[model samples]
Target: MTRVDDPATTSPEQARAAFRAGTVAPTSGWAPGFTQTNLIAVPRDWAYDVLLFCQRNPRPCPVLDVTDPGDTSTVLAPGADLSRDLPRYRVWRHGELAEEVEDVRGLWQENLVAFSIGCSFTFETGLRAAGVPLRHLEQGRNVPMYVTNRRCRPAGRLHGPLVVSMRPIPAGLVGEAVAISGAMPAVHGAPVHVGDPGELGIVDLGRPDFGEPVEADPGDVPVFWACGVTPQAALMASKPPFAITHSPGHMFITDRADSEYRVPVQRNE
Candidate 1:
């Protein structure tokens, strides 16, 4: 893993340079405070179903931006190229992962539609600011993620169990973590479950379906939140003819701020 301190110095051009040069890696801390999105590239034929899937499962799949077919530029992140902004991407053909690539420029097609979904990293900064410690961030490991028995509402050919990321929160700070994160609805907003993994049908806390597992300290409860990986799992289950997504923890950094996603409400006159 090539660690680049001062990701602020790394512009979109630098990011593309790193990816094109075969330095793709997990982008957890890179471009902190910027909204990092999960990529879901699918054939135009399956675009509607994929969009509906994200709409129905907002927590696990919050839609931040979508690109027009064959267009690599997302208005959400103007000038940021999707094909090379992300550190790594996973290419799935007929539901099976065909290969991993640093850049997807070769696979770009006129019939491809790209969706940028919200990721938990947007909210982790809020959690850290609120004094909620994150084990994965501290350990420099991928956050633990799992496929739960809870089924996500199916849209067209898309349907699968919801995936969640687990974070160990101190017994005293669990409520604080929930309150702070809940304020940002754009990024999988709050904790879906506070304690007891079995309630969500998660059997072994240490054995996650995806990502690396972190140790939960004594008196710390395993907190669960809906994850963006849900769509990737759904794609694998539904076996779409062609699909592409960012590698786990490798996200496309955007210019949007996490605060911009806060839900706005109008007061009664």
Candidate 2:
């Protein structure tokens, strides 16, 4: 793993600088108070379908921002170049992963539109802050993600099964974790399932469809969150002609604050 300054205390600009300087590492724990995101870039012809698909499945695909067709900048991180901002990028051809590279600058196309989706990693900071343990983080591993039997409402030609990320939370903190994360709908908002991987078609907690895996300790409850990777899974099934996405766990760190997506209370209260 490429080591830089601790991300939890790094400013968003500094964190992004590391990514841009060729520091390829998981974005989680970096810039804790800021938002990190999953990315998907599709051709102009397929943009509408993907955008609508995100709209239809808001929980797993909460869109934080969409770049105008062919535009290289996004409102989420103004002045940053989308094609090279992320530490790693995955190129897909007809829905199949074809290449993995540190930068997408070589494949940049004028007809492509990029969609930035809310990542559950953004809520992890709040969970940790609230005293909820995240085993994956403590172990320096990627949170495990699994594909469930659940189906997302289809949109045009874009459709597929849902994907979720798992974090082993202390059984006692499950309620506190839910209450803390549930308020941030834009950051994948709360746990979808609190226990039993079998219920989600995840037969083995030691093996994950994506990312590193962590076992639920003796008294820890396995908690799942709707994941931004859901779109990548859909792309793998739907077979769009051409697409690009951030490599799982390698996210786009944004200038936006994590608090920006939280449920707000009345000013009078």
Give the number of the best model, judged by TM-score: 2
* Tens-digit lDDT string for candidate 2 (145-187): 8999999999999999999999888889998888888989998
- Candidate 1 displacement at residue 37 in angstroms: 0.9
lDDT of 2: 0.89
List, residue by residue over 1-269, the lDDT tens digit for candidate 1. 44455654665456555755667666665555667788899999999999999989899898988888998898767777888778888999999999988888889889999999988887776777778888887787888898888999999999999999899999999988887778777888888888888889999988988788898778888999898889999988999999889988788877787778766543469
User: Model 2: how far is 239 from its true place, Å?
Assistant: 0.5
Candidate 1's displacement at residue 54, Å, is 1.4
| Deviating ranges (above 4 Å) for candidate 1 | 1-3, 6-17, 264-269
- In the predicted model 1, the residue pairs found to clash are none
TM-score of each: 0.91, 0.96
